[model samples]
Target: MNIKYILLPLVACSAVALAADPPVEEYVYGMRLDIDKVVAISEPDELYAPCRVVSAQMTYEDSAGQLRTLEYLRLSSVCSDIEGSL
Candidate 1:
């Protein structure tokens, strides 16, 4: 049996597996959200879908010492909305 023959197939299989993953949809970009007493920065290029797909919920603490929840649609990829402070 020739080892070379098996090598080609292995490389092709690896490539297919990598492509199977879905790309990121929604991105938090440069904005921050407050959750229920916990604040977390969203990952760069993080994929997410609003109501049409999976919703991203944020829970963190507020200045008032109360837990708060913010539900919003990620309009980074799907929508063309620019958010930033100049």
Candidate 2:
């Protein structure tokens, strides 16, 4: 008998639910290196020497307004002399 009352409540409930939902976050994978901060130089083994590297943790917001963080590695390097000795 009263469709308007039922429809109004339904619309209001939908709007509230959408507003209360948490923002979506995006998952990312990759390597980011900063060549400026080379902490040390040591050979982990005979084959590779990952130069100790340090970089600031990356922070940004995704498209859905969610806070995101990309952690940096403590040590990473492209060992050009992989065949050389320590």
Candidate 3:
């Protein structure tokens, strides 16, 4: 006899379910990144030997069904003898 009461509860329940966290599989899938194919370009310099990326790791996510990649770089400088990530 009261459609509004039924519809309101249904809408509230749907909203709660949608606000919950995603499944473990989906979370892992979105956070997975493949770094096996990443290669750093090396530059040769006479004076400092050029600062270059020694290693790289990428984290990828499927946001709204689109692939997005984030790169983390570990750089090495021959002149200052410094190694760090960026």
Best by TM-score: 2
Q: Tens digit of lDDT per residue, candidate 1, span 1-86?
A: 89879998999999998765333334355656443356543322534533133355445566676545444454443233222321
Clashes of 1: 10
Q: How well is each residue in 1-86 modelled by candidate 3, as lDDT tens digits?
A: 88998899999999988765333222232555443432333333335557665433333335344333343445554534544332
lDDT of each: 0.50, 0.48, 0.47
Q: Could you tell me the C-alpha RMSD of candidate 1 in Å?
A: 12.8
Quote model 1's TM-score.
0.28
Sort by TM-score, top down from the best: 2, 1, 3
Select the stronger candidate by TM-score from 1 and 3.
1
lDDT string for model 2 (17-56, tens) is 9876444323345544223333333322433445545443
Extract clashing residue pairs from model 1: 25-47, 26-48, 35-59, 35-60, 36-59, 36-60, 37-60, 37-61, 38-60, 38-61
Which window of 10 residues has the lowest lDDT sum in candidate 2? 34-43
Per-candidate TM vs. native? 0.28, 0.31, 0.26
RMSD of each: 12.8, 14.1, 13.2
- As a whole number from 0 to 100, the lDDT of residue 21 in candidate 3 is 32
Supply candidate 2's per-residue lDDT for 62.
49
